[model samples]
Target: MIAPAQGGLRVTAVDSLAAGEGIVPGLPIADARALLPYLAVREADPCADAEALARLAGWCGRYSPLVALDGADGLLLDITGCAHLFGGEDILLADLTRRLTGFGLTLRAALADTPAAAWAWAHAGPGGVLPVGVARQALAPLPVAALRLPDGMAAALGRLGLRRIGDLMDLPRAPLTARFGDAVARRLDLVLGRASEPIAPLHQPAPFRRQLAFAEPIGTRGDIDRALEHLLDGLLVDLDQAGQGLRRCEFSVFTVDGGVQRIGIGTARPSRERRHVLRLFAERLEEIDPGFGIEVMTLEAPVAEILPAQQAALEGGPATGEAELARLVDRLQQRLGRHAVVRLEPVDSHIPERAVTLVPALAPPSHRPWMVEQPRPLRLLPSPELIEVTAMVPDDPPLTFRWRTVLHRVAQTEGPERLSPEWWRDRPGTRLRDYYWVEDLEGRRYWLYREGAYGEPRAPRWYMHGLF
Candidate 1:
C-alpha cells in the first residue's frame, strides 16, 4: 500500500512478493515501480486500518477482556490469568499466531514481563516467550528504535554511535536526561520492570466470569446449552461461596470467524438458582447466530448483589411465593423485555397523577405507605380525561356527565373532598382539585375531579379520573 508522504507518494506497506524485491515502507512509489515494472499498489487508508485494528482488539476479548490497542498496527492483551485456558503461554501464543495467519495477516507476537519489553521483542528481537528477569538481557541487542522514543531520537542516537539499547543501559542517567530528556530513562525503566505501566483495557474483566473453549467448533443448540450449563455450574459455586447472587448476566458466543453473539438476561431479584437462571437463558438461546460455529463461550455477571442463604422446606417442596413470583417476572422479562414487567409503587405526592410511579417488579418497597385511609380505586388512568358535566350547584357533585361520548346520570354521591397542589412541586397558577365518588344510575361508579373552583374567573372543568 502507498500513501502520500513528505516529498512524494511512498510505499506504506508491501506484500511478501514485493518485500523480496527490496521494496520497503518509506520508499518512494516512483522508485518502487522502477524496481518492479508491474507492482500492484493500493492507497493506504489509515482510518480504515485503525477501525479494523479496533475490531480485531474487540475479538481478542475471547482470550482476555483486558485487551488494549498498542498502536495503529498492534494489540496488547493482558493474559496474566487467561493463558492457562489455552494450555499455556506457549500454546496460547501459537494458537493466536496460527489463527491470525490463517486470516491472511502477516504478524509477529511475543510475551515478556512488561509490555515495553514484549513490544521490543516482537518488533526487533526473536518473537517468543521471554522468561522473567531476562527483559534486560533480551532487549540489549535490539536497536534504540525499540525503546519507542520520539521521532528522530533513534536516528540521533545512531549518529552518536549509540545504536543499541545496551549502549544506553550503561550511560549515566543524569547525562542522558540532560541530553535527551527523561524519555530514554522512562522507557528503559518501563521495559526493565522498574516502573509500572498499566494497560488500559477496552473493557474491564468481570470479577464473576467463566469461559469454556471447544477443541472443535460447535454450532448445535444442544451443544451450546450444555456448554452454558457447565459454565453456570462452576460460576454459581463461586457466587454461593461468596454469599452473593447475580442480578444481571451475559452469555457471549465467540465464533471461529471472529464474530461475537451475546445473549443477556436480568433477574427481578438477586438469584443463584441454577435451574431458574438456566431457564431464563434458554428462552433467548435461539437468538445466538453461531456464525461459522462457536469456539469459545463465556458467562459473565456484571451486576451482583448479596443474597443470604434461605431456609428450605424439609420435604423439598416448591419455592416460596416471593421466589416463584420473581421467577415468573424473570421469565416474562426474558421473553418480553426488562421494562415490560413492573409494579406500581406509591410516590410521596398528593396529586393523583403523581401519586405513584412504575418500578421494576422486584424493586424495594417504598418507605411511604399507600393512602388506604382515603379510599382509592382498584385502577387509575395514566392521565385524567376531560368530561362534560351538569351539576345541581357549581361546587356540588356532578348530577350527570358525558365521557367517551357516553352519558351517565348520578344516583348516589359521597364526596367533594378538596386536595391542594403541592406548593413546592406544582407550578404557580396550578389549581386545587375537588374529587367525587359518584355511582351512575346503572350502578357503574366513577372517580371525577374538578380542576377549578366556583366564583373563579373561569368556571371549573370536570375530568373523569378513574373507574371504581
Candidate 2:
C-alpha cells in the first residue's frame, strides 16, 4: 500500500496473489482490506523500481544497443537491423520472452516500424510481430487509451462514446482537433505512423564494431590472440576507409558457458595503427579466462575521431618522438592502471589550491591557458598547513616563522598579493587572504598567506600554502 494523498492509503500496486483475489491498484486500502481481512502490505518504493528498470534496460543491450524505457513498466528496443542476427523477429522475441520469464517477470513484446505503434500494440494487441505498413489497420480496434493520452482526456473521450481508436480514425481531423485539442490528433497520428516517433536509447550505440562467431569453441591462448588480430585487422580497414581512428577499443569474448569477458584499452590520441592497438591488447590478453572455451569474439571502438592521412616526413622529427612517447605512456598505463599516470592541468581560478588540477595522462589538454604573471610555487600542498609567524605587521610578510617546529629566518620577501574569495560562489563568512612569497635563510622559498584582516577580534591565522 502507498499513501499518494494525505488522508488516505491506496493500493498503488498488487502482486499476482492479491490481484487474483480482485485486489487492484488505485483501490482504497479500506475497501481492499474489507475484501481480504488477511492481507500482506508493504510501502511502495518507486526509486528502487526505477533503478531495477534501468538495470533491466542495460541487460537488454545484448539484444539491441538501442534500448529505451517506456514508462516504468516497459522497454522499447529498436531491432531494425539486429533481429536478423538472432535468426528472425519471431525467434528473437521468443528468446527474449523465454529468458525474462525464467527470471520471474511477466512481459508483453510488440514490434512495428514505429515506436509509438509498437508501444500501443504491446499494451492492447496480442504480443507478436506487426509487419510494416499496417499500423493503422492493426491499431484500429485498440482502446483510445492506447494512444497514451492524459487520464482526464481519455476519460472525456470515453464519455463521448469515442472509446475505440477506429471510431476516431474515420472522423474528420479538424473536428477532433477542435473538440479535444491538438494532443488528440498528434497522439493519433503518432500511433497511426503518420508522425515520426523516435526512441532515445539509454546508451549511445558504438559506430564501429566487428564480431566473429566460431562453429567450434576455441580455448587456447593462441586461438584468442589470432582472433583478436583478425578483429583488429578488419576494424582498422573500416576505420581507414572512413577516415577516422580509434581513441578507445574494447575486446569482448563470449564464452560457451554464457559468460562474457571483456578487456579495454585507450590511446593518447586517435590512431588507426593496427600494430599499436594489437600490442596494447596483447599485454592484457592472458588475463581473460576462456571459461569452458569461447564461442564468439567482438571488437568495438566506442570512441573514435577524425584522423586525416599524414604525409611522411623526409626525416625523423618531433612527431615521431611524440608518437613514441604516447605509445610508452599507453603501455605504462596498461600495466600500472589509468590513475597512476597523470598530468597537471591549470584551472581558471584565483585560489592557489584551485589554480591547477591533476588529470589522467590520456585526457585532453586544458583549454584554459596557464597564468604566468604571478610567480607560483613549483609544488603546492594538498591543503594549507597552519604555522606561527612573527612579522612587522599582521598584513605584512613574515620576518620569521615556525613550520613543522623548525624556525626559519626570512632572507628575502617578494609580495603580499591580496586574494579574495569569489563572492558569486555564495560562500558565507569567508574573508579575504593576503599571500606572500618569502625566502628563508637557507634559500628555500615558501608561499604563505594570512586569512582575515589585521587587528580584528579574531586574530588572523597564517598558513604555509606551497613550496618553491
Candidate 3:
C-alpha cells in the first residue's frame, strides 16, 4: 500500500503521513510499523491490478497499435513506423505525454535502436528519442542499473568504479566479456545500440487501422466524406514510410445508433498515391448509406504487401493503362472479398511436368527469378499416370497402347525418355520412372509413362497422364 498510495501522491509533496516511510517493497509489515508508528494501509488486490494492467494495454492502441506492458508499471511501444503523426519525434513525445496524463498516467517514453536502450532512457535519463543512430551517446550518462544487470554483476561493476554506461563503454571488449561473462556485455551492447533488440508488441499483427471519434454524430455526405479523408491521410503516411502498399483497404463508419457503413477498395498493383487511392475508394464511399449519424470512421489495411517498383512502358513503345483492369478487379474483389482476384508465380521442380504451381499474387516471388538449363513444361499435368507398352525395344514408345479406354495406334513413335526419380531425397526408397512421348493416329499428342520397371517378364501397366 505504501507504493500504491504513493502512486499519484509523491513522497515530498504529500502531507498524509502513513507509517512505513523508511520501509521498502520487500520489507515486512511489522518492520514497517516499527519504522513508523502510524501506517495508513490497505489490503493489496492482485485481481484488480491484473485487470487494470490489461485495460491499460488495450487503451494504448489509440497511440500505437504496437504496445506491450514491460512490467507492472511500465509499457513498451514500438514507435518505429508510428511516429510523425503528432508532427515530429519531439512533438510526438509531447503529445504522448499529454495523452497519458489525460488518462491519469505518469509516463516515461524513450526511442532508441534497441528496447534496452529505450528502456534505460525512459527510466534513467530524459524520456525522449535518442536521435537516430546515436543511442550510445545519449545512453552514456545513465547508471549501470539501467542496463538491467544482475545484482552480482552490478556490484562487481560498482566496485570497479564503473557506475555509469560511459564507464562500461570505455572498457576493452575482451576484458569486459572475460570478467563479467557474455550476459553483461550483451546487455551493454543492447542498451548502447550496438546489438539489435526488437520489441514484441502486446497484440498480434493488426494491419494499419485508423479511427476518428467525432464530437457529434455526422449524417451528412459532406461530413462523412471529410472524415474519410482524414483517416486516409494518416494510413498513407505509414504505408509510404514502410515502402508497402495495401492490396486491400477498408473504411468502416460506426454510427451512434449501432449502425455500420463499410466501404472497401483494392488495387491491381501496389500504390502510395493519396489522391489515386482516395479516388479508387470513392466509388464505395458513394454507395455508403448514412442511415444514422456516424460517430466514428476507421480505415484499415487487412491485406498488405511490399510494393515493388514497376515499369509502365518499354523503351521503344507506349504501354497499356491499368485503369480498366483496376476498376474491374476492384469491383469484383470488393463484392466477392479478397479471394476473388488471383495471380500466379512459377515454382521449380525436378519432374518435367511438376515444374509449376498456382500461388497467390501477394506472395513474394521465388528468390531465383531465372533458371536457364532446365526446360519448364509449357503446361502442367495434375498427376502423371503410367502407360502399357508392347514395343520390343527397351527405350521405344509402344506401337499400340490403351489410353482413357481408347486403344490408339501409334502412327509415329518417339524414343522412351527414361527419367529417374531424384535419389537425394532417399536412396533406399527411390524408384526409377521411365517416361515416353507418343503421337497417335489423330493429331492429338499425349504423355504416358511406366513406373518401377521397363520390362523383364512382367507386362507394364499404362496411363494417359497429360496432353500437349
Candidate 4:
C-alpha cells in the first residue's frame, strides 16, 4: 500500500509477492514503479486500520477480558488466568493465530512475561512463547531497534557499534542516561520486568457479557436467533445472580469474514423479562447481516440497574400500573423513535403556555402536580391569537369580539382573574393580564385574556388563549 509521505507517495506496506520482487515499505512510489512497472498499489488508510484494530481487540474479548491496543497495529492481551480456558498457553496461542489467519490476516505474535518483552520478540526475534526469565537472554541477540527506542536513537547506537541489545545491557547506566536520556533505560527495564506497564483497553469490558462459538459457522436467521436466545439465557442468569436488570442490551455477531454486526435495544425500565426483551430485539433482528457465516455471538448489557425481586399479584396475573405502562412505552419507543414517545410534564409556571413541557416517556415522574385549583381549558393554543374587542366598560369582560375574521357575541361571562407577570422572567414595563371565561351565543366556551390592565399607559389588548 502507498501513502503520502514527506516527499511524495511512498510504499507503506507490501504483499508477499511485492516483497519477493524487491518492493519494501518507505520506498518512494517512483522507485517502486521503476523496479516493477506493473506493480499493483492502493492508498493506505490509517483511520480504517485503527478502526479495524479496535474491532479486532473487541473480538479478542472472547479470550481475555483485558485486551488493549498496543499501538496503531498491535494488540496486547493479558491472559494471565484465562489461558486455561482454551486448554493451555500454547493451545490458546495456536487457536488465536489460526482463527486470525483464517480471516486473511498476516500476524506475528509472541507470548512473554512482560508486554515490552513480548513486543520485542514479536517484532524482531522469531515469534514464539518465551518462558519466564528468558526475555533478557532471548532479546540480547536482537538489534537495539527491537527495544522500540525513540526516533534516531537506534541509528545513533548503530553508528557507535552498539547495534545489539546485548551491547546496551552491558553499558553503564549513567553514560546511557546522559547520551540518550532515560528512554533507552526505561524500555530496557520494562523488557526485563523492572518497571510496570499497564494496558489500557480500547473499550471497557462489559461486566455482563456472554459469548457462544459455533463449531461450524451458521448463516440462517433461525440459527442466529437460537444463538441469541442461548446468549440471553446465560446473560440473564448473571444479572439475576447480581440482583440487577439490564437497561440497555447489545447483541454482536462475529462473521467468519472478520466482520462484526451489532444490534441494540433499550428498556423504559430495568427488566429481566426474557419474553419482553426478545420482543424488543425482534424489531431489529433483520438488521443483522450474517456475512459468509457467523462463527461467534456475544450478548452484553453495558447499562444495568439494581432491581430487587417484587411480589406477584395474588391472582397470578402480571402486575398492572407502572410495570405495564413502562412496557408499553418501551415498545412504542422501539416502533416509533426514542424521542417520539413523550409525556407532558408540569412546569412550575402559572402562565398557560409555560405550565407544561414535553419530556421523554421513560423519565422519572415529577412530584409536582398539575394546576387544578381552577378549571383549565380542554385545548390551549401554542400562542394566544390577537382579537378586536368591544366591552361595555373598561374593567368588564368583552361584550363582542372578532377573532380570525369571525365575530362572537358574548351570552355570559364568569371571570376577570388578574394574573401578574413574573418579576424574575418578565422585563420591566411588561404587562399583566386579566383572563375571562366567556360563552358565545352558540354555547361555545372561550378563554380570553386582555394584556395590560385597564386605564394603564398602554391600552389593553384582547387575545383568545384557549377553547373549552
RMSD of each: 4.8, 5.1, 11.8, 5.1
Q: Higher-TM-score candidate among 1 and 4?
A: 1
lDDT of 4 by residue, 119-184 (tens): 998999898799887777899999999999999999998999999999999998999999889999
lDDT of each: 0.89, 0.85, 0.68, 0.89
In candidate 1, what are the lDDT values of residues 280-303, reduced to their tens digit? 998889899987899998899988
Model 4 regions lying over 4 Å from their true place: 34-38, 55-58, 61-67, 170-174, 220-222, 309-317, 349-354, 371-468
Q: 439-461 in candidate 2: lDDT tens per residue?
A: 99889999998898867788899
lDDT over C-alpha atoms for residue 264 of model 4 = 86
Q: Quote each prediction's TM-score.
A: 0.78, 0.76, 0.47, 0.75
Q: State the TM-score for model 4.
A: 0.75
Candidate 1 lDDT for residue 293: 96
**Cα error of candidate 1 at position 374, Å:** 4.4
- Candidate 2 minimal-lDDT segment of 10 residues: 310-319
| Steric collisions counted per model | 0, 0, 7, 0
The segments of candidate 3 whose C-alpha lies over 4 angstroms from its true place after superposition are 2-20, 129-134, 206-298, 303-468
After best superposition, candidate 1 residue 326: deviation in angstroms? 3.7
**lDDT score, candidate 3, position 124:** 94
Off by over 4 Å in 2: 1-7, 211-231, 250-264, 278-299, 310-319, 332-378, 389-401, 407-462, 465-468
